[model samples]
Each structure stands twice: as C-alpha cells, then as structure tokens.
Target: MWLYITIGLVALLIGIAIGFFIARKYMENYLKNNPPINEQMLKVMMTQMGQKPSQKKINQMMQQINKLQKK
Candidate 1:
C-alpha cells in the first residue's frame, strides 16, 4: 500500500516539473518572437508628439526600453 502511494506521489511531482518547464519555454519563445515594441512605433509616437526623432534619440529610447524590460 505504502509503495503504491509513494509511486503516485513521485509521478505527480514529475508531471508538475514537466509542466513548469514546458510553460516556461513557451513563454520564452513567445517573448523572443514578439517583443513589446519596436523603433518604427517609437518614431511614429515621437512624430505624433510633434518632434522629429533623431536616430540617436531613437537608439537611446530603445536602450532605455530594453533596460526596463530586463527588470
């Protein structure tokens, strides 16, 4: 009886571990394929704000965005 109970518990743990890893990997791939934003969107936003964006400014903003996302 005790052997059966131990085996069931171990199986449950293995399932949980597999599920966690699969979900983690899927999220990582999703984020990699579809980031939250890009340069063109930033440029459009700045243009809408009535400021012509320079490449330097755009690059700076991109760095800031990437830094924030890392946190």
Candidate 2:
C-alpha cells in the first residue's frame, strides 16, 4: 500500500512538472508570433497622449520594449 502511494505521488509530481514546461513553451511561442503590442498600437497610444509618433520614434520605442522583454 505504501509503495503504491509513493509511486502515485511521484507520477503526479512528474506530470505537474511536464505540464508546467509545456504550457510555458506554448505561451512563449504565442507571444513571439503575436507580440502584446505592435507599432500601430503604440502609435495610437502616443496619439491619445497628444504626441505625434514618428516612424523613427516608434522604432526606437519598439527596440526599448524588446530590450526590456529580453531582460
């Protein structure tokens, strides 16, 4: 009885670990393909804040965002 209980607990723990990794990988891929924010969204946000967003400015902001995400 004790052996079966120990085996069941071990299997449960292993399953949990594998599921966490799989979910994490899926989300990373999803986010990479579809970033949370894009240039258009950024431009709209800047416009709403009363700033005229230039292409160069948008590019710079995107670089900064990518840098932060990498960290």
Best by lDDT: 2
Output the worst ten-in-a-row residue range by lDDT, candidate 2: 62-71
Candidate 1 regions off by >4 Å?
40-53, 67-71
Score residue 39 of candidate 2 by CA lDDT: 98
What are the per-residue Cα lDDT tens digits for candidate 2 across 20-48? 99999999889888889999999999999
The positional error of residue 44 in candidate 2, measured at the CA in angstroms, is 0.4
Given candidate 2, what's the lDDT at residue 60?
99
Candidate 1 lDDT, 1-71, residue by residue in tens: 99999999999999999999999999978887888789999999999999999999999999998888778
- Provide the overall lDDT of each model, using Cα atoms, as 2-decimal numbers: 0.94, 0.96
Error of 1 at 66 (Å): 4.0
